[model samples]
Target: MTVVLLLCIITSQLTVVLSSAGNFWTYKGSLGADHWHLDYPHCGGIRQSPIDLQTRDVVVDQTYLSPLVFSGYDRVSNLFFRLENNGHTVQVGLNDKTMMISGGGLGATFVAEQFHFHWGAVDERGSEHSVNGRHFPMEMHIVHFNKKYGNFSSSVGKVDGLAVLGFFFEIGRFNEHFQEIIDHFGEIQFKNQHININSIPMIDLMPARLTNYYRYHGSLTTPPCFESVTWTIFNETIEIAEEQLVEFRTTIFENDKSDGGVFMDISDDYRPVQCMFRRRLYASHPSLKYDMASPRENGNDGVSNQPTRLLFSMFLVCIWCILPFFSF
Candidate 1:
């Protein structure tokens, strides 16, 4: 089967529309972040996301933390994906069974549903979550739904229903793998436009170091801003070329240029940092105190079941090799 056909079948089973109420929400003017709560109550909730993560304030709790783990994230063969320009953000949907995460401070297994990004008009500020009030050029959110809560839509309304792995991006060397997604941005320049890509090395998008991270409870950055997320922010940042950053900021939000509607630039899709109520942030690594030691270098034994990963990989490889021989 073709990649598009496969993606259609997969999306039919896992797609979810997360738009807000009747009124539309943008990042500026009246319908901006300051007024989102007027339409979506959860946007004004106390446990909102995009908070400034202060290193000095965060407590070091090595006992309750685990190394971040990515399961089935290294799919490089016979993989199919769906990319959509949902007006609000550029979202790429993936099959849950193929990419998942467990451990690494997450109490339950979460299935990868989709991943999207939030960038700025320039390189100065774009990241939603900042480190000691320092913002990066852009931020990527790898969103996952708790397996126990069923699908992505169902999980959003319940506490502990979602897990978002956030990574900040700095302008530097070119990321070739990330270009696969960037190259297709033209096709989905308008609202609701979607296309299927052959494959993307999802693991390559993340930084090499996954051991050091911050853990906290928060809500969705967009409305309805459901406070049902377990957030994990990595300490390291991904480097992308300046040209790649330009491609992202140039994406349009209108359905067509021919229409009278203004061609809104999809530059600042990120929400401002919300107030950090009384929530305590936890770090996986040891704090800079006068006593405790850093976590074990190799403690992050990803995916506890080695046999399961091997068996799943073997099964996928076998299927890939014989796929052409059989009719779907």
Candidate 2:
């Protein structure tokens, strides 16, 4: 009788441990990304995303990576969107089916599905995919599915099923376009909270230039970690005010208010850079100089001319000094 009771107690404890390990996941604590493989097998697989983009190692492929064509992104007057705090990250569901993208080495047209963000607790550590070992303040992913697959749901596991456009964010002057989305933060202060937004042009949220980017075949950054994404990480970054970043870090909670649990802020919700085993990162433009920290002027090469300007300034100073000595 004593042996049977002990055996039953051991069995119950084992069941509880397995249940907790399998169900939930988070960015930190025991259920963090490090332990995710216990529940999700693909999280530990090769071709995982959010790898550091070492620019020097990238292959320039102008022939295959032509400029991408955007369609229906500017249409906004009659469109509707759903913005929600989904316990993990803040996501915006794209309601318009007309918005689509093609080219830039993607063989098939992909219809836009939804967009979401990954951020850190502070301004310096938010972005998921880093450039030359530097993280941006934030990162945005615009997800799409191959038109041939019918919809995002049916396209989950195929090699060419998904195409995700990634853009990084930097601190700068106020962005009026992004302000439209930020204004609704109050309504989604808790998890599962969502609000419908009307008339926001999808084009306004992206950088003006869309030609230069880095492409690679990788899995989704989040779980189930499907190795189906054809990633196009733009070389240009979107700018937002520092105050707006604070609102993202502070305003949203991961748990619902009705749960009567300790409220956790949904910050630092990005996965760490994964290993690149045999994959090659490709650059769209051959001569494009990639820099995540510096600012680029509109309608010019992405490289900064600050060093050239400094050289010219020194030459002028030398000429000025000699002019006084050579006075006639």
Candidate 3:
């Protein structure tokens, strides 16, 4: 049988596909081309689906707040500011007092992991999925973990228990302000190694209309293809210069060129889009529309109210879902 692009490449194990676009490893197979779909022979398991996450719609009614304050862990990454808690790089903590509704899995405190970018080698047109059938320069995923689970391994190969924030990147000139992330790309020194990087702010890398993202329950689109996380993809596209995309991907050798005759040059690291599985979609949450639903008596024993580095406009909409779920 001919394998389909974007979806339909099926097997019992995860496959890592290396392309000029980047390196993507998948368990349920991956898309060969952009916007491709496939028959999901394996669906319905709690930890099966990879993309297009769906869950009970939780309505957030109360005001949301979290610490924009955070630090970066990786050096070569383009994430201007990121936060980590319980091994997660970017995360948020929400409690009942600050929460409002429960249905689509909102009001849960999820930790932010390392933020990264994806781009084409030459420039223009590397991301999956197009607007009105149009593709953009790249896509950025601000991955997160559900504090309810307590750890990544606990939530591993699992969905309905996590959240991932997605945003599209358009090609343009590198914003001078955006360079804060670009500045440190050289410091990372190597891949897979992490450090406690400081001073990066989450506010600088965000758009103003964070409340207006499309919410859905999707899989990690990575290995194990667990349909366990919630996705909030913004309708708006952010701009980064063609040169900026270049700068973002470029990596330096850990040692001096003279010390070792060969210092490896690295570039292009990203996870590709997985099968859509023709999954059903859900309606956006009401509290996100800035509507405060009828108040529930705030319980004293609930998630604590905390600020976030990248959990933009989210705490208010996610407070209610925090109390109902927990993983150890």
Q: Evaluate model 3: give its TM-score.
A: 0.53
Mind giving the per-residue lDDT tens digits that candidate 2 earns over 219-306? 8898888899999999899999999988899998899879886788999999998777668999988655456544456545565565
Cα lDDT computed for each candidate against the true fold: 0.81, 0.86, 0.45
Best by lDDT: 2
In candidate 3, what are the lDDT values of residues 162-182, reduced to their tens digit?
666667787765666567556
TM agreement with the true structure for every prediction: 0.79, 0.82, 0.53
Error of 3 at 280 (Å): 1.8
Candidate 2 matches the true fold with a TM-score of 0.82
Candidate number with the higher TM-score (1 or 2)? 2
Q: How many Å off is the CA of 86 in candidate 1?
A: 0.8
Which candidate order results from sorting by TM-score in descending order? 2, 1, 3
Candidate 3 has an lDDT of: 0.45
Instruction: List, residue by residue over 1-328, the lDDT tens digit for candidate 1.
Output: 1343344345324422443457788888767887777778777677889898877657888777878678888876575789989887888888545678998778899998889999989898889998867789999999999998779988988898999999999999999989999899989998888999976768888999888889889999998899999999988899999999999888656345445566887897889887776688888886421212223355753323434566788799999999999986
